[model samples]
Target: MTVLEADRLSADSNRRRDPISSRGAARADTVLAVEGLTVGTGRADLVIDVSLDVRAGETLCLVGESGCGKSLTCLAAMGLTSEPLIRKSGRISFLGQDLSLLRENQLAEIRGRDMAMIFQDATAALNPVRRVGMQIAEVLVVHRGLTWSQAMKQAVELLASVGIPDPAGRANAYPHQLSGGMNQRVMIAMALACRPKLLIADEATTALDVTTQVQILKLMKELQAETGAAMIFVTHDLGVVAEIADRVAVMYSGRVVETATVDDLFERPLHPYTRGLMACRLHATTTSHGRIAAIEGTVPSPSKRPEGCSFRPRCPYASDECMALPALRPIAGIYGADQHRAACHFAEDFARAGS
Candidate 1:
C-alpha cells in the first residue's frame, strides 16, 4: 500500500479501538489524527507530508532542530497561520473530523473549544496589558458563551490547577508582573481552560530554567491525566521527550525521518538523523574538552532543500543511494515492530554495522 493508504488504515484501526477508558468503563475516543500534512510559507514548502496521531491521554512529540518546521505544523493545525504566509495542504482530522479545509468561522469555533495551543515563548504570547486571568476567560466567553463573571471564576481555578499560587490575586495582575515560570503557567491555564480534547504545546518550556521546566512539564502531565487531553509536544530537546513522550516523530527538512517509541528512539534509533541527534546528545564520560557538543552543519533552508534524504547533506553514513529521496520504510526489528519506520536505504546495514 501507498504511504497515504497505510496511514488511513492505521487511523481507521485506532479509531475502532478506543483505548482510552472513561468513568464507569466507558471509552474516550481518539482525539487527533493528522495525515500527509504539508505546511509552507511564500510558495516554498517548509515542512512536507507529516503524518501522526494522538489518542486521548497520549503525548506524541515532534523533535528536531530549529528549522525542522515543528512550530509551523502546530500553527497550521489551529488555523493560526498568517494570511498569504502559510499555505497548507493535506488531511488534518480532530475527533475524526477533517480540519484541513475549514473556513475561518469553523476553525474559530473549534480553536479553543476542541483544541488549544501553548506557544513557544510564554512571556511574549501573553498580552502585556491584559490581566492573565481575563485572557484565560476570553476563550470561555467566546466559545462556551459564559458570562464574564462566571468565566473569570473558572479562569482563577484553572490557574490554580496549573500550580499558580494565589491564583485569585495573580489573575488580576498584568503579564509583566509575573515571572517567567508564572507566565508559562498562565499560558497553560488558558490552554487547558476548556479542557480541550487536544493540546499543542510548541516548545512551551524552552525559556524557563531547568527546575521550572521540570515543574511545568509535571504540571502538564498532571493536567493531561486529569482531563485526558491528547498532546502534540513540539521541541528540540530529546531529554524532554525522554521524560514525557510515548512516541516520537523525528523531522528533518520538511518530512519525518524517523518515528518510534521513546525507548526505541533512544536505544535503537533507525534513521541517520535520529542517530545523529542521539550521538550529539551523548555527554562525554571521559573527556578532554568541557565545551558543549553540537551537530555539525545546518539544516538546509526550505527553498534549498536537497533532492534526496534531507539529512543526506549532514549524514555521516551518506552513500550514492542517499542521492535518491528515501521513503519511510518499515524496519525489520524494533519495539514497535510494525510501527518502526525509517526513511533510509541503508537502515538495515547501518544497524548491522553498528552506526
Candidate 2:
C-alpha cells in the first residue's frame, strides 16, 4: 500500500473506537480478540499479560524490537506454541469462538479454513522438494475437500491473484528454483487459499527487496480488502506500519506499552520507547552513516523484567513514579472514547511535549 492509501484510510477510520479493554461490550465486530495473554515456560514468562484485538477488515500492526514477544504472541494466537512454552493465562477468541476451549481436532478445522498465518521466512516455510502449487492445493484439499486436480487448478489462480507471472509454470516450480519473492508469494497463496477470515502475518515482507516488498504489501492490502479478512501483522519496521496499519500496538518486553490509531501514534507517541523509535526513523533518513538515533538499551530479559516498567532503564523520562509498572490506561478526559492508551506514568506529560 502507498502513503496516500494509508493516509486516506487513517482519515476515514473511526478514531473514536475504544481500545479492546473498553470494547468488551461490543466485541461482536471483532474477528480476533486476545485478552490478558501470557505465554511462558515454567521458569519465565516470554509474553505477559498482553491484550489486543483485530476487528473485521482492519489491520493491527505489532511493533517492537526483536525478543519483544511479537512472534511468540502470534504463535500463541495460532496454537503453534511448542510444549516447552505454554499459554500460562489468557483468552483468544476468534469470531466469538473460545480457542482455548477447542480440542486439537477442532482447532485443525479452523487453522487453515477460518484462520491462517504467514511466517517470516518463506524459504523454510515451504517444502523443499514439493512443487509450490501442491503446497497450496494441499490446504484446499484438506479444508475445502477439493479433489487433487481441482485443488491444483485453484492453486494456479491463487498464484495469479498474488501477482506471480505465468501462474501455471510457476505452480510446478520447486522451492529451490524460485526466488525469495516468488516463494513468499507462494506462501501467501497457501495462506489465502482458504480465504481465512483472520490472517496473521509475521514480518511477511522482511526478506524481500524494496520493490517486491512494496508489491507484496499492496497485494496483501488488495486481497484483504477483497476478502474482508481481519489481520494481525507483526512487524518491527515502523515504515511498514505507516504503509499498512490502521491501528498500532507498541510492545515492550512481553507487554503492550501503547495502543492507538496510526495517526495518533505518529502524531503524539506517549511512551519514551515509542518516541525513540520514531526518532530513529527520522535520523536514518536525515543523515547517512553512523549517526542514526537508536534506543539506548536492548529489551529487558523476560526472566528479569525489572521491578517496575520494563522500559524504565532505557527511558529518559523515567521518574520515581515508575517504580511500579503503570497500567495500560486511556488518556484522561478522553473518557468514553477510550481508544488512545499508554502504559507510561508520564504519558500525559509526554503527549503534551509535542513534536
Candidate 3:
C-alpha cells in the first residue's frame, strides 16, 4: 500500500515539476489566507501588518531568526493565543471559514480536523504518559470517527510510513522511550492522522540532527505530495527553504520584509535582509571568504523596533528613505515579476545596481 502511495506521488511530481505557484502568478485556489494580521499585548504589537496566501498543494516557508513572530503568527492562525497577547486586528481565513471569529469550541473543532500544527519540540508536543500510538489514534478516533482498534491499526501504519522499523512494537512504546527522531516522527504522524487541509510546522526540525532533519523533511515532502495539503513551514534555516519551499517569506522584527518564489529568491534576493540572510549561508561561501558571513546584530524586540525599517540597524544598504516604513508592494517589472514583493524603500535601486 505504501509502495502504491509512493508511485502515485512520483507520478504527481512528474505532472507538476515545480511548486504550484511557479506555474502562475495568481493562485487560483487558496487554502489559507491571512490579511493584515496583527497580534500584540496592550503594550505593543508583536506581529503587525502580515499577510500571505497559502494556495492548495503549496509549501510556503517563513524564514527568520527567533523572535521575528513566525511562531506567533502560526498560533494566531490557529486561534490558540492565550491571555494578554490578543490578536490586535487581522483576518485568518482557512478553507472559506473566518478563523478570527470562531469561538474556542469552534476553533477546537477546526484544529486537527482542518488545520494541524507540528510544534518545534516534539517531546513536549506528545503526551508523556500516553503511548505514542494511543495519542495518534485519539486524533483519528475524535476526528475521523474510528474505533480504538481501527485507529490503532492506522496509527501503526502511520508509524511505519514515517520509517519506524517495527511499527507495531514502536507504537506501544512511550514517547520518552523513543529517540528524538522517533518522537518527531510520532508528532508528524499525529498531525497527518486527520489528513488536514492545512499543516503548519513550526520549527519542527530545529531539534533534530542534520541527518534526521533531512530525513524528516523528505518524509514531510512525500506526505504533503500524497495529501495535497497546503503547508506553512516556519524555520530559521534557509537551507530548509531551498530544499522544500515553493514560496519564501523573509520576516524581520515581526513583519515580512520580502516575499518571492523560491527560485527568484535564491537567484536574486531583493530585500537587504534577504540578501544578508543568503550571504550568511555556508553553501554560498564555497571558497571566497575564510569565514561564513553573518548578519550583524540581532532581531530587535517588538517594542524596540526602529522608527523606520526594523532591519535598518543591521542592513548595509540603508539610506535616509529607510527612515520610513516601506509598504510591502510588488517589485516593479522585468516581466514575470508581479509575484515578487519586497518591503524595502531601496529594493528597486538595489536590484538595478546589482544587475
Candidate 4:
C-alpha cells in the first residue's frame, strides 16, 4: 500500500483499539513524553526546555540541522548519554514512568525491552569483530534471558522480518561482509529483538543509498504497525519526514522552534526556521541550478548561541526586537490549538505577510 494509505490505516486502527506495551503492559496510550528536557555539560545547557510527545503507534519526526540537538535529545531519552560529561535534567517518560529517575541497571533492562534505538551509520553501531547473528542475539539474551541457541534462532527470524535474504547465513556474517543496506537491516533486526514499545531512529538511513533508504523506511513502517511501537525519528531530510512523520518538530541550536503536523508544517509554517527548511527542498521545484537549495549560514554553536531567536541571525525577518529571545507562542493561522507553535518575535506578522 502507499504511504498515505498506510498512514490512514494506522491512524484509524489507533483510534479504535488500545494497544498495550509488550514489556510492562501498562495502559499504553502514551508511549513517550519528553517534557522540559535539558541536556548539557555541567558548565552550561546545550539543549533547553525541549518538550515533545509520541503517542502509541505514532511517528513524531524531529527534523533539524546536524548540531540542533536532535540526536542529543534522543540519546538522553534512551539514557545513552555519557554521564559526567553530559548532564541531563527534566522528565523522559516511557510507558508512564520517568526514565530520569531510574537507576542505570533498571534503565538498561527497560531500554531494549520497552524502548529501542536505530542508530545512524549502522556500520559504526554494529560490532566489527562479532558475527552479525551474535550481535543481534545479544539483545534477546540480555533482555529476554533466552538461551544462546534460542536467541540465535530468534535473531535469524528478526533478520528475515526486516527483509534480509537468507537470514541464517547472513547472521553468521561479520558487519564488514554485509552491504550497507544489509547492515542497516541487521540493525533494525537487533533493535526489534525485544519488541520495544518505543523506537528512536536517529538518521537510520543516512548511510544508505536512495533505494536502500526507501526499503529501510518501508520496513520500519511495517514493523511499527505490526508491533504498535511509537517512533521518534530524528533526521535532517525533509523528504524522509514527509514520508514517515505524523508530526514534525523543527529544532534549531538546541530548542524546538516549531512543532506541527507534517501537513500543517508544509502548508503553513509558523516559524522562520521552519520556513527556511521548507524552502531548501528541491522536490517540488523544477530547478536547473544543479544545486540543492540550502538554508544559509550554519546553526550557531551551543557555546555561542545568540541571545535572540537562535534562528534570528540567519533569518531574513529579524528586527530590533529580535535582539531578545522569542518565546514559543501560539498564534492563529493554520493548524488549530496545539498543532501550531513558533518561536519568533513577529510570528503573526510573518504569517500574515506569507499568507
Candidate 5:
C-alpha cells in the first residue's frame, strides 16, 4: 500500500479505537503548553511564534537540522534562555501555571522539582569538580529537602536505576573521569532525581554510540513510563523520532513547518521540508546511486531568512503564491480529522498527490 493509504488506515484505526479525540480532551491532558513563543536577539529572531503542547505521558519530538531552532525552543520552555537572546513574546504554561509570569527564583523552584532538562552535552552540563553522585544529590537536597548524606545514598540508587554499573563506586567519579555514556546516565539520574512532571531531553543520545544510544533510549522510555512524565525529545535524527516520538513538530528557519502523529508524519509528510528530511534518510534503495538525497541549500540563517516562507529559496515547489507566508494550518478533509498541520501553500496538493 502507498503512504497515503497507510495514513488513512492508521487514522481510521485510531478513530475506531478512540472515538472522542477532541481538542478539549487534548488541552485537559496537556502537561506543558507554549503559545506564540518568540525568542530573539536585538536584531533577529532565532525562534519565531512556535507553539507546542505535550500531553501527560506523551513524547513530543522536535526535529530539525542544526540551526533550525529546535534546541532554542527547548531552552525557552525550560526558562533557561540566557542573555543576548530573550523571550520577546510567549506564554509558557506548565500544568496550567503560566511560567512566563514567574520570576527566576520561582522558575528555579519549579525547574528541578517540577520540570527538568538534560542538555545536549552531558560533560559540559555536569560540573567537572563535583563527584557525579554529589551532582545528582544536589537536586534532592535543594528540592526534596534531603540531608547531604541521605541524598548521596539515594543518588547511588538512582545511578543504579539508570543501568550504571557499580553505582556506589561510580558515583564518586567526577564528570571527566566517566566515559560519555556513563556521564549521560548520570545526567539522566540527576534529571529524574526529583521525579519531574516534565522532562526535556535535548539530544540526550546524540553523542553516544549506536549500542549505547539504543540502551539510553530504552532506559528513558522505561523511566518515563514508570514515572508517567511527559517528554520533549529534541533530535535531528528521524530514526530516533521513530523509536521514541508519539508526535513530531518539524521546524525550519525558526518556525514550525509541520506537526503530526509519528505514523502520519513518516507515512504522509505534507510539508516539502518534512518530505525532504524523510528522503534524506538512507535506505536500501539509496545505495543505487551511491549518493543520498539531500535538501538543497543550507537552512537560511535567522538574520538572512527570506521575506516570505523562510524555506522558499530552497523549496522545489516554490511559487509566487509562496511569496506570502503560510500559517501552520490543518490540512482539509480526512487529514483535518487527525489534526495534521503544515505550514506550506501546497500542503493540500502535496497530500493529494501523496508526494
Candidate 6:
C-alpha cells in the first residue's frame, strides 16, 4: 500500500483503540509521560518545555529538521543525557515511576529492561569489535539476566525475527561484515531483546536506502505489534511520519510547535511551521521544472533565539502579537481522541477557517 493509505489506515485503527481503560476515566495505558522537559547546557537551554505522551501500543512521531531538539527530548526522556546537557526542569515518568527520582544505577537497570532506544546510526551505536550476536545477547544478559549461552541462542532467534538472513552465521560476524540494513536489523533486535514497554527510535531509518528503509519500517511495525510496545519514532521525514505515526508532535527551534493525530495534522496543520513542513514534501504532482518548497531560514541557535516565538522569524503568518511566546494550547471546535494543540497565536483562527 502507499504510504498515505497506510497512514490513514493506521490512524483510523489507532483512533478506534482507546488509550483509556474500559472504565474510561484515565490514561491507564500510558507508558511514557514527559512534562515540562527542558534540557540545556550551562550556556543555554537547548530543549524547552517539551511534553509528550505515548500510550501502550501507540507510535508517537517526533518530527522536525535537524537541531530542532527532537533527539534531545528523547534522550532526556530516557534519562540518558550526558554531561553539559542536563535535564534542566522536567518530570519524566515511565510506567508510573518518576525518572528524576531514580538513582543513576536504578535508571540504568530500567533502561534496557523496560525502555530501549534504536539510535540513528547503527554503525556508530554498535560496538565495532564485538560479534553482532554477542552485542544483541548483552542486553539479555544485563537486563533479562540470562546466561551467556541462553542469550546467544535468543539473540540468533531475535535476528531471525528482524528478518536477518543466515541468523546463526551472521551472529558470529562483526558489525562491519554486515550491510547497513543488516546492522540496523541487529540494532532493532537488541533494542527489542527484553521486550521493552517503550521503544524510542531516533531517526532510526534516516541513513538507509529507500528499499531498506521501507523494510526496516515494516519490520519495526510488525515487531511492535507482536510485542505491544509503545514507540517514539523520531524523524525529519513527514512521509515516514504518515507511514508509522498514530500521533505526531512537530518541533521547531527547541520546542513543540504543534501536535495532533497523524490524520488531523496532515489534513489541517495549524502551526505555520507544520504547514511549511508538509508543503516541503515532494508530491507526485510536482512537474520536472517545479521548484521544491522549503522553509526559508535556519532554526535559530538556542542562545540567540528571538524573544517571543522561536518560529516567528520564519513564519509567514507571524504578526505583532507573535512578539510574545504562545503556549501550546488545544484548538477549540476540534474534538477527537487526542486534542490538537499548536503554539501559535493565530492557531484558533486557522482552525476556524479550516472548519
Strongest candidate by TM-score: 6
lDDT (10s digit) by residue, model 3, range 1-355? 2332344345345223343343223455788888899999988898998998887788889999899999999999888898899998988888877887778888888899889999999998888999999999999999899999999999999999999999999999998999999999999999999999899999999999987987898899888888989999999988778777878899989999888877788887899889998887765326855776888899888888899999999988887988999998777753456667899988887667666
User: Would you list the C-alpha lDDT of every candidate in the order shown?
Assistant: 0.80, 0.87, 0.85, 0.83, 0.88, 0.88
**Predicted candidate 6, C-alpha RMSD:** 2.5
Rank all candidate structures by their TM-score, best first, as comma-separated numbers.
Answer: 6, 2, 5, 3, 4, 1
Name the better of 1 and 3 by TM-score: 3
**lDDT digits (tens) for residues 275-326 of candidate 5:** 9999998775436477768999999988888989999999999999988999
Q: Is candidate 4 or candidate 6 better by TM-score?
A: 6
Error of 4 at 305 (Å): 1.1
True-vs-predicted CA distance for residue 257, candidate 5, Å: 0.4
Task: Tell me which of candidates 3 and 4 scores higher on TM-score.
Answer: 3
Where model 5 places Cα greater than 4 Å from the true spot, the runs are 1-26, 336-338
Tens digit of lDDT per residue, candidate 2, span 36-75?
9999999999998998898888899999999999999998
Candidates by lDDT, descending order: 6, 5, 2, 3, 4, 1
Off by over 4 Å in 1: 1-28, 282-292, 353-355
lDDT (0-100) at residue 247 of candidate 6?
A: 83
Weakest 10 consecutive residues of candidate 5 by summed lDDT: 11-20
The candidate that wins on lDDT is 6
lDDT value, residue 222 of candidate 2 = 81
* Model 4 lDDT tens row, 152-198: 99999999999998999999999999998999999999999988889
Q: What tens-digit string does per-residue lDDT give for candidate 6 at 1-355?
A: 3764664575454343443232112377889998899999999899999988888889999999999999999999999899989888988888888899999999999998899999999988899999999999999999888999999999999999999889999999999988888999999999999999999999999999988888899889888888889999999988889888888999998999998888789989999999999888888855736687899999999999998999988999888999999999877877552468899999988888888
Q: Candidate 5, residue 9: CA error in Å?
A: 17
Model 2: lDDT of residue 99 = 97
Candidate 6 lDDT for residue 220: 90
* Structural similarity to truth (TM-score) of each candidate: 0.89, 0.93, 0.92, 0.90, 0.93, 0.95
Clashes of 2: 0
